[model samples]
Target: MRKDVVPVSSPSPLPPLSPPAGPPPCPPARRVSLPAARPVRLVLCLSPVLLAGCWALADRPVASEGASRLAAADPGWLLAGAALTCLTWVAAACVRQGSLPDKLPPGLLLASQFAAGAANHVLPGGLGAHAVTLRFLRARGVPLDRATASIGLYSLARSVTRTLVLLAFLAACPARRRLGELVPDGPVPVPAAAVAGGALAVAGVLLTVVPPVRRPVTGLVRAALADARAVHGRPCRVLALWGGSAAMPLVQAGTLVCVGTSLGLGLPWEQVVLAHLAAGTAVGAVPAPGGLAVDAALVWTLVSFGAVPAVAAATVIGHRVLNDWLPLLPGALTLSALIRARAL
Candidate 1:
């Protein structure tokens, strides 16, 4: 009986179950670290002005001379030159868009090209601009290969169009004989062409023989060809590509003509245009940033065209001011805005 009672005694109360541990009260959501946009924008806004001031100070003599010349130039013609300069960027944007099938925001596309002008001056062979564009395309979800192909297509189209334009101008221009004189008659070109061709052949042979190199290169070529076909298939793209390419050189030439007129250069507009096209086509292969060699070539060509050296120099200075210096600050600002907005 006693044993049964003992056994019957209520089992010791079970230890109070500890509350099941929860995910350590989920540590207060960590705030995502992000760049402060306001400070970045402020810096972006100020940096260009500061840099421009420094640039002016560093070359004060040239800046002062340029300023005086610009002040003396005809404002009307100068304004026209500025307008033409702006159109060049628009044409560039068109070519860029035409290179890819994916639709990009028109506003941003224009802005990017404007920004690209500044970048183009900083790096040799337009690498800075291409880098900006590549980043932009990547941000917009374009595949790396496709984006790269687009750049190649754009460059190819531009070069081909430029050459065609040059030929056309040469045939139509009354000054073709003079331009022909500018080309030094030598065996240098033949050797250069042979070297280039041999290099290409070597590269091709390597690509064909090496499996590791062959596969990626072949794939890239296929992709590029496919994109090119796709781009050409659309009428709008074709127009934008070829039309923009054609328009860019013309617009640029027009700018030079306007600058020449403003400075009272003796050469006719037609001659000025011809000289610009010739100089650009000739020196374009040189890897000088911001077309330094092209500038020198242009001045030389203009002087040969019977322009007064002083006037030609002044004209070139004005053209550079309108085409390059004026836009640089704004372009840098646009680039900064794009970066801040993550559009690039």
Candidate 2:
């Protein structure tokens, strides 16, 4: 026992562990690219509005005329007009959101609407905006069929509301009835209408003949109708859909009033509103990009309302600069950004 104890002295304590080779060089101080990205991001952020302004100024006489009128414009009235113009965009956004069943981020929804304004100018019949919005809704994870349905519902609602609002105004202001006589006596061309109908019929026949086109179209129509019914079932959606649509034309009319006032066009306010609504309804369906026909009709309508020819021309031209052309640049910019972000 004594021999065993002498041989088996307790194991000596182990030495302490040392720091790992100078802390492994402190992980090479990772470089952050945040600063580099900042200025680029800032430029991108500002480019849209700047682009919009520059593009607006590029339109030779329209931009120059608008600027001239703005310079002499009663600051108060011009400010009001600007405010109303801004609200029209908001209304458009609200309608879009309301039409969708899936919840959308308000900011993005608003952005899509802002972008849509430019697209309307690019394609006749609002094809560009419709295309953008359809893509946007799909990006938001809405089913393709429902998105299509919602867009259809939105357009239908807008067209109907415009008519209803016009009717309401006509009911309220009987004096505006006299202006209806200004509608030209020229008959619509039967041959043109017949040709358009023939083309549509041929297209329909082709759709029926082509399985690829027919299947998806049939499914889309069914899905869309179902979604539309679902949307109509919700009262809040209904209100937003129709209410926002109804307010838009009124705001547009208000924009015209402000423009007229700026140009010293001495006309009855109600008459001006009536004239705009009437002209819009008359020429809105024609496939003219930027509504050349609508612009002409508006000028003619104003002249019929006893506005001087020069004043009528100037007013329509100025409002076109504001309502249509002004939004194009910013809208295109927004569209580009949205595409990059995968939101369109």
Candidate 1 lDDT by residue in tens digits, 1-344: 45544445677888999888886556678878567967777786556456655654665675567678989889998889889999999999999999998899999999999988877766768887899899899999998888999999999999999999888888888887887667787787999899999999999899979999998778778889999999999999999999999999999999999988888897888889889888988888789876778888998899888899988888887787789888877888788788778898
- Candidate 1 colliding pairs: none
Q: Please state the error at residue 57 of candidate 2 in Å.
A: 7.9
Please, what are the lDDT tens digits per residue for candidate 2 over residues 34-109? 8888777667655555655655555567768766766776777767777888899889887887677667888998
Q: Give the winner by lDDT.
A: 1
Q: What TM-score against the true fold does each predicted structure earn?
A: 0.86, 0.78
Report every candidate's CA lDDT.
Answer: 0.85, 0.81
